[model samples]
Target: MKVAVIGCGLIGKRRSQTAMEHPLSELAIVVDINPAAAEAVAAQYGCESATDWKAAIAHPDIDIVAVATHNGLLAEIAIAALQAGKHVLIEKPMGRNLAEALKMAEAAKAANRILKIGFNHRYHPALAKAYDLFQAGAIGEIINIRARYGHGGRPGYENEWRGNPELAGGGELTDQGVHIADLIHWFAGLPTEAFAYLQTAIWPIQPLEDNGFGLFRFGDGAIASFHTSWTQWKNLFSFEIYGQKGSLTIEGLGKSYGIERLTIAYRKPEGGVPDLEDLVFDLPDTSWELEWQDFIEAIAAKTPYWGAPEEGVSAMRMLDALYRSAKAGAPIHV
Candidate 1:
C-alpha cells in the first residue's frame, strides 16, 4: 500500500512515520497547506511533497490516504480519497459530528474501500491486556464503567482551531470525549440512554465547552460515566470496569499522564478482601504503530479491525446524544 498523508501536523507526521515503517506500505507523498511543513515531513521520510491534498489523493499510486487535518476537513478529504479508490484512515471522532461521519461511512461503502478510524488508545499495552482479560471472562458480567480523561490547556489554546465551534463541531466532548465514548462502547457496547452537561469553564470559548461530563445507561441497569476536561490542572487518564467476578482498572497513558498501569482485582465470595494484581507499562507509546499494522493486515488479509465504520458511527452517535442531552437538559435515548 502506498500512502499519502494530508496535513503535516503532529499526528500526520506520526501516521507518516508508521506508514513508512510498515513493510507493506510506502510513504509516497506528504501533503499540507503549508509547503514547508509538507516538505519537512517528506524530506524526513524520503517521500514526495505536495501542497494540494486533492491532487495527491487522486494520484493512482497512492493506495492509502491518512486524514489528520482538523475536525472540519476530515470528512471532506476522507470521502474524496475513498471515492478515488484509496483506503482511508481518519483521526478519531470520525468527523465533526454524526452527520459527517455517516456521509464518510456511506462514501466508503459506495466506493468499496476500507475506512478505519484512528483509535490508537485501544492498542495501548495496558488497555490491550485488560481487554484480553475481559474477553477471556476474567471480569465476568460487566455491571458499570467509570472513566476520566483530561488535561489542562496551554496558553493560547482558546485561539486554536479546536476552540472554534464551527471548526471543532463541539469542544471537549468531540475532542477527548469521543475517545471515551469509543472506549466505553468497546467495553460495553452502545448505551441505551445518555445525559450530559457541558461547560466552558475557563477557555472563554463560548458555545464550545472546555469541560464535558456525561452519563450513560446500558441495558440491565448497567451504567457508565465519564468526564473530559481542559480544566484539569493535572493530566490524567483513568478507566474502571466492575463486573460480577472482579474489576479491571487502567490508570495513566505514559509520559505526562504518568506510567500506564492496569490493576486487576478478583472479588472474594466471603467478601473480605479481593486478590489484586498490578501490571505497569513503563515504555514509549507503540499504539500508533500497532494500529497501523492492524489496518494494513486487515486490508491485505480481510481480517477484522478495530475502529470499524459502524463503531465510529456508534461512538459519534453517543456523542451526538450527549450534546443533545446537554442542550435539552435531559437524558436522550441513543
Candidate 2:
C-alpha cells in the first residue's frame, strides 16, 4: 500500500515511520503547508514531498492517506481524500464540530472508502489488555468508568495553534477529552445524556477552556465521569472501570507518565479481602503502528474499520452535547 501523510508534525512523522516500517506499506509522500517541514520528513523517509495537500491527495500512486492536520482541517482533508477514492486515517476529534464530522462520515459512505479516526489510546498495551479482560467477564458487567488525562503546558503554550479556537475547535476537552470520551463510548456504548463544566482558569488562551469535567450516563445505567486538563503539574493518564463483580484500573502511559500498568481486583463474595492482579508493560509504544496496521488490514480485507467514521461521529455528538450542556448548565440528551 502506498501512503501519503498530510501534515508533517509529530503525529505525521509517527504515521510515516509506521508506513515505512510496515511490510505491506510504503511512505509515498509527505505533505505539509510548510515546504521545509514536508521536505525534511520526506527526505528522512526517502519519499516525495509536496506543499499542497491537494496534490498529495490527488496523486494516483497514493492508495491511503493519513490526515494528521489540526482538528479544523481534518474533515475537509479526509472528505477530499475519501472522495478521491483513497482510504483515510484521520486524527482525533475528527473535525472542529459535529457538522463537519457528519459531513466526513457522509463522504466516506458515499465514496465507499475506509475511513478511520486515530484513537491510538485504544491500542495501548495496558488498555488493550483491560479491554480483553472486560470482554472476558473478568470484571463482569461494567457499572461505571472514571478517567482523567492531562498534561502541563510549557512556556508560551498560549501562542501555539492549539490555543487558537479557529484551529483547535476547543481547549483541553476537544484535545485530550475526545480520547477519553471515545474510550467511554467504546466500552459502554454512546451515552444517553451528558453534563459538563468547562473552565479557562490557568491558560490565557481566549474563549477556550483549559479544563473540562463531564459526566455521561449510558443507556444501561452505566455512568462515566471524565476530566481532561491542561493544568496538571505532572502528566497523568488514569482510567478505572467498575463492574458488578470487580474493577479494573489502568494507570500511567509509559515515559513521563510512568510505567504503564493495569490492575484488576475482584470483589470477595464472602465479604473478605478481594483478589488483585497487576499487569505491567515496559515496552516501547506501538499504538501508532498497531492502529495503522488495523486500518491497512481493514482495507485489504474489505472489513469494517474499528475506528470508523461512524465512531467519529458518535464521539463528536457526545462532545457537542457536552459543550452544549456546559453552556446551558444542564444535562443534555444525546
Candidate 3:
C-alpha cells in the first residue's frame, strides 16, 4: 500500500523507517511544515516530499496516511484522511479531550475506513505474554496492578511537541499517562472510576505537569496504581500484577526499542521445579516492526484494529477525571 506519513519529526521518521521495511508498504510521500525536513526524509526514503499535508492527502497513490503530527491535531487530520478514502494510523493521545476523539470516531464510522490509534504497549512481547498468562489462568484473578513509566528527561525531548500542551496535550499524564490508563483498561477491563494527582515538579518551561499519579478502580476488589513521570534520573518502565494463583511481572517494556523480559511466578501445585521461575521471552526481533506489520495486515483484512477510537475516548475520560482530582484534591468518578 502507498502511504503518506505526515510529520517529519522523530516519531514520523521512525514510523516511516519501519514502514519502509514492509514489503507491502511504499513510502508515497512525507509532509512537514518545514520544507527542508520534508525534503530530507523524502530523499532518504526515495519518496515525494511536500510542506503541506493536503497535497500528499490528495495524491491518488497515497492509500494510507499515518499521522504523527501534533497530538491536538490528530482528530482533525484523521477525519480528513477517513473522508478522503484513506486508512489512518495515528500516534497516541488520539485527542486532547474526549469530545474531539468522539467526533473523529464518528467521522471514521461515516467514512467506513480503518482508523487505528497507535498504542504500541500492547505489542511488547513481555506485556503480550503477561496478558496471555492472565487470560490462560496462569494467574487466577487479577486483584491489583502496579505500573510505572518514566524516563530521565530523555534527550531530544527537552524541547519538542511532548513538552507543549498545545501540541502534545496535557502534561506527562496526558502524554504518558494516557498510555498506562489505556493499558490498565486493556488488561484489567474497563475502569469504574479514577482519581489522580499531577504535579509540575520538573521541566520548568512546560505548563503541563511532568509527573502524574492515579488510582483506578476497576470492578470490585480490583484497583490499579499507576504513575507517569519525566523526572526520573534513570529511565524505568515496569509492571507487576497480583492474582490469586500467580504473580506476573513484565519489566523493561518501555522506551522506543523496549527490551521485553517477562517473569512469571506461580505457586507450586505441590512439588514443582523450584519454587518459582522467570521465563524469558524469545519471540519477535523488534516490537515496532511487529506493530506496523499488524496495522498493515488489519488494513488488508478490513477487520477491527487494536486501538479503537472508543478506547481513545475512554482513556481521555479517565484522564479527565484524574486532572479533576488533581485540581479538586478529591477523587472524581468517571
Candidate 4:
C-alpha cells in the first residue's frame, strides 16, 4: 500500500516514518501547506514532496492517506480522501466537534473505506495490559474512575494553533481532555451524563480554556472525573479505576510523566491490606508503530480494528456534552 502523509508537522513526521518502516505500506509522498516542511520530511524519508494535499490524495497509487493537519482541516481532508477511495488515519478529537466527526464517519461509510482515528494512547504497554486485566475481570465491575492529565504551557503558547478556538476547537478539554474521555469510555463505556467547568487560568487564551474539570455519570451507576490542565508546572498522567473486587491504578506515561507503572490492588474480605501487584513498563514508547501496524493489519484482513470511527464519535460525543455542560453550567445527557 502506498501512503501519503498530508501535514508535515510533528505528528505528520511520525506517521510518515511509521509508514516508511512498515512492511505493509510505503511512504509515497508528503504534503503540507508549507512546501519547506513537506520537503524536509520528504527528504528525510527519500519520498516525493508536494504543497498540494489534494493532488497527493488523488494520486492513483496512494492507498492510505494520513491526515494530521489542524483540527479544522481534519474532516475536510478525511472526507476527500475517503471519497477518493483511500483509507484514512486521522488525528484525534476526530475533528473540531461532533458534527464534523459525524460527517467524516458518514463519508467513510458511503465510500466503504476504513477510517481510523489517531488514538495511540490505547497502544501504550501498561494501559494495554491494564485493559487485558480489566477484560479478564481483574477489576470486577468498575465502580468509579479518576484521571488527571496535563502539562505546563510553553511560552507564547497563546499564539499557537491550539490556543486558537477556530483551529483547535475547545481548549485543554478538546486537546488532552479528549484522550482522557476516550480512555474513560474505553474502560467503562460512554457516560450517561456529563458536567464540566472550564478556566483560562494562566494562559492568555480566553474563550479557549487552559484548564478543564469534568465529571461523568454512567448508565451502570459508574462515575468518572478528570481534570486536564495547561498550568500544571509538571507533566503528569494518572488514571485510577476502582471496582467491586479490586482496583487498577495506572500512573505516568514514561519520560517526563515518569516511568509507566500499573498497580493492582485486590480487596481483602477480612478488612486488612489486600494483595498488591505492581508492574512497570520501562520500554520506549512504540504506540505510534503499534497503532500503525494495527491499522495495516485491519486493512489487509478486512477486519475490525482499534481506533474505529464509531469509537472516535463516541469520544467526541462525550466532549460535546462536556462543552455544552460547561456553557450551560449544568449537567447534560451524553
Candidate 5:
C-alpha cells in the first residue's frame, strides 16, 4: 500500500511514521500548506513532499490517504480522496459538523472505499484491555460511565488555529469531547438524549468553549457523564465504567498524564469490600500504529472498518445534539 499523509503536524507525523513502519505499506508522499513542514516529514521517511493536497489526492501511486488536517478540512480532503478511489484515515472529530461528516460518508459509500476515523483512544493499551474485559462479561452489564480528559494549553494557545471557530468549529468539546463520546458509544452504544454546558472560562476565545460538560442517556438505561476541558492545570485522562458485576476504571495516558493503568473491581456477594486488580502499562504508545494496522486489515478483508464513516457520523450526531442542547439550555433528543 502506498500512503500519502496530509498536514505534516504532530498527528500527521505520527501517521507517516506508522505508514513507514508497516510492512505492507510505504510512505509515498507528505503534504502540508507549509512546504518546509511537509519536506521535513517526507525527508524523515525518505518520501516526496507536496504543498498541494489536491495534487497528492490525484496522484495515481497513492493508495491510502491519511487526512490529519484540522476538523474543518477533514471532510473535504477525505471525500476527495475517497472519490479518487483511495481509502482514507481521517482524524477526529471527523468533520466540522454532522452535515459535512454525512457528505464524507456518502462519498465513501459512493466510491466503494474504506473510510476510517482516527479514534485512536480505542487502541490505547489500557482502554483496549478494559474493552476486552467488558466484552468477556468481566464487568457484566454496564450501568454508567464517567470520563474526563483535559490538558492545559501552552502559552499563547488562544492565538492558535484551534481557537478559531472557522477552522475548529467548536472548542474543547469538539476537540477532546469527541474522543470520550466515541468511547462511550463503543462501550454503551448510542445515547438517546444529550445535555451539555459550554463555557469559555479561561481562554479569551469567544464563541468557542474552553470547557464542556455533557450528560448522555442511552436507550439501555446506561448513562455517561463527561467533561472536556482546556482549563485543567495538569494533563489528565480518566474513564470509569460501572457494571452489574463489577467496575473498570482506566486512568492516565502515559507521559504527562502519568503511567497508564487499568483497575478492575468486583463486588462481593455478601456486600462487603470488593476484590480489586490493578494492571499497569509503562510502554510507549503504539495506538497510532495499531489503528493503522486495523484500517489496513479492514481493507484487505473487505470488511466494515472498526471506526468507519458511520461511526464518525454517530459521534458527530451526539456532538451536534449536545451543542444544540447547550444553546437551548435544555436536553435534546439524539
Candidate 6:
C-alpha cells in the first residue's frame, strides 16, 4: 500500500520509520505545516513532501493515510481521507472531544473505509499475555484495575502550545489520560459511571488539568480507578488488573510496553495459594509496521474490520465523560 503521513513531529517521524522500513509498503508522501520538517523526513524516508495537506490528501495514488498530527487535526485529516476513499490510522483522543470524534466515525461509516485509531498499546506483549491469561480463566473474574501515566511536563511546557487548552485539547488528562481511557475501554470494556478529580497543582497549564484521578463503574459491579500527571520527575505508564484469583501488571512507553516483564500473581485453583510469575518479553512491535500490515491485509480481504472507527468514538465518549465528571465533582453516565 502507498502510505502518506501528515505531520513530521516526534511521533510523526517515528510512525514514518515503520513505513520507511516496511517492504510491503511505500512511504509516498509526507505533510507538515513546517515545510522544512516535512521535507527532511520525506527525504530521509525516500518520499515526496508537501506543506499543503489538502493537495496530498487528494493525491490519486495514496492508499493509506497516517494522521499523526496534533490531536485536534487528526480527525479532520481522517475525515478528509475517508472522503477520498483512503483508509486511515489516526492518533488517539480521536478528537478534542466527542462531537468531532463522532463526525469522523460517521464519515468512515459512510465511506465504508477502515478507520483504526492508533492505540498501539493493544499490541504490547504484556497486555497480550494478560488477555491470554484472562481468557484461560487464570485470573478468574476481573474485579478492579488501577493505572497511572506520569512524566515531567514537557520542556517549554510553560510557554508551549501543549499547555494551551484550545490547541493541546487538554492538560495531562487529555494529553495522557486518553491513553488510560483507551486502555480501560480495551481491557475492561465500557463503563457505566465515571467520576474524576483534576487539578493543575504546580504545572503552568491553563484551563486544563495537569493531575487527574478517576473512578470507573463497570457493568459487572467491578470498579476501576486511575491517576495520572505530567508533573512527575520521570515518565511512567503502567497498569495492574485485580482478579479473583490473580493480578497482572503491565508497564512502559511506546514500543517498550512489552519489553518489560509481565508480573502475575495468581492461584492455580489447586490446593496451593496464589504465586507470582515474572515473564520477560521482547520489545513490542509498535513501529507502525505491524499495524500498517494488518490494515492493508484487512482492506484487501474486505472482511469484517478490526479497531473500527466506532471503537475510537467509544473511547472518546469515555474521555469526555471523565472530564465532565471531573468538572462537576460527580459521576457521569456513559
If scored against the real structure, what TM-score would every candidate get?
A: 0.99, 0.98, 0.92, 0.99, 0.98, 0.93
Candidate 1 ranges beyond 4 A from true positions = none
lDDT score, candidate 6, position 142:
82
Better of 2 and 3 by TM-score: 2
Each candidate: RMSD: 0.7, 0.9, 2.5, 0.7, 0.9, 2.2
Model 1 scores a C-alpha lDDT of 0.94
Candidate 4 lDDT over 1-334, as tens digits, reads 9999999999999999999999999999999999999999988999999999989999999999999998989999999999999999999989999999999999999999999999899999889999999999987999999999999988787788998888998899999999999999999998999999999989899899999999999999999999999998899999999999999999999999999999999999787898999999998999999999999988899877888999999999999999999999999999
Off by over 4 Å in 3: 154-159, 254-259, 268-274, 281-285
Query: How many pairs of residues collide in each model?
Result: 0, 0, 0, 0, 0, 0
- 2 or 4: which has the higher TM-score? 4
> Candidate 2, which segments miss by more than 4 Å at Cα?
none
lDDT of each: 0.94, 0.92, 0.82, 0.94, 0.93, 0.81
Model 4, position 199, has a per-residue lDDT of: 96
Tens digit per residue, CA lDDT, model 1, 1-334: 8999999999999999999999999999999999999999989999999999999999998899999988999999999999999999999979999999999999999998899999899999999999999999998989999999999986687688898877788898889999999999999998999999999889888889999999999987899999999988999999999999999999999999999999999999899789999999999999999999999998999889999999999999999999999999999999
Cα miss at 224, model 5 (Å)? 0.8
lDDT of 2 at 128: 93
Give a tens-digit lDDT track for model 6, residues 154-237: 656768767767666778887778878877787788999999898888776767888988899998988999988877666777
State in Å the error of residue 127, model 4.
0.6
Compared to the true structure, candidate 1 yields what TM-score?
0.99
| Higher-TM-score candidate of 3 and 6 | 6
Clashes of 3: 0
Candidate 6 lands at a TM-score of 0.93
Preferred candidate (lDDT higher): 2 or 5:
5
